[model samples]
Target: MELLPFDEYVRSLDRKRMSAGVLFRDAEGRVLLVEPSYKAQWEIPGGSVDAGESPWAAASREVREELGIERVFTRLLVIDYVPDDGRMPEGIAFVFDGGLITNAEVAALELTDPEIVSAGLFFLDAVPSLKATLAARLAIALRAAQAGEPLLSENGTELT
Candidate 1:
């Protein structure tokens, strides 16, 4: 048997894409969702984790980059494993607790040009009407938020 260098061995494995998003709420408990110019469906404030970036950091970075607001992630909400759907590779999606933003904070949110079209605060119950995959993830996130524990889900269904 032959062995390759540690770095070489690590590089030989298949890599999955990682994305992080933040779940924001208002005093009325409305979920904050953003409309991305690039996508047909609405999305939360987040993006793909860059190389060597932690998921938590990615969530914070995405919020700043996408919304032009600085938010500190309080805790992890949900971790979703999405299978490849013949278009993109398999991926792990993370939703972080964005904490409640005041009306002033919400008003101050600035959308990134050409990336974010607008932002809206919707009731948690309305999340299911969004994109299928996103709705699934947010459902898990809302549950995790209420329970104060992170959830493990596969495409939105909680894994026992």
Candidate 2:
């Protein structure tokens, strides 16, 4: 891979933190994974929140832009922060529970960014290895859904 200019690389390395939205299983418990051509991981569908955008709005917008499906509803699942960075600028991953639907209504799955190689749905029991934090979040979301609680786990832990 080509390297970035020294100043630009330094600026990125120095930027301490940001927030990301995570969209996992749709309402029915089917897992959704996106492989954006630009990103190496088959990430949960969400992105950085723009300045002034609420987490809920950010989630919906990202789903629309990245997945092309309307995220009809979304709410806070949890606020996750990695603490080693002093938390001043830690990635506050906001997990969002989005509606259950497929893109077949308008067309086959489309990637807002061409770099997205493809999208797939997998059975929960068959989910592949996922990034650690994201896998935890998915387990949380699925547990919430199976129990009919949107924002709380059966163990009395709030999903958020």
Q: Model-by-model lDDT, in order? A: 0.85, 0.62
For candidate 2, lDDT tens digit of each residue in 5-124?
999898888432445555555445677877777746666777787877776787777778877867644556655654444534545566676646464532476676775677777554
| TM-score for candidate 1 | 0.87
TM-score for model 2?
A: 0.66
Per-candidate alpha-carbon RMSD to the true structure: 2.3, 9.6
Estimate, for each residue in 109-152, the C-alpha lDDT of model 1 and write its tens digit.
77756788888888756753477778778878888988999999
Name the 10 consecutive residues with the lowest summed lDDT in model 1: 124-133
User: In model 1, which runs have C-alpha deviations exceeding 4 angstroms?
Assistant: 1-8, 102-104, 124-129
| Window of ten residues with lowest summed lDDT in model 2 | 151-160
Top candidate when judged by lDDT against the true structure: 1
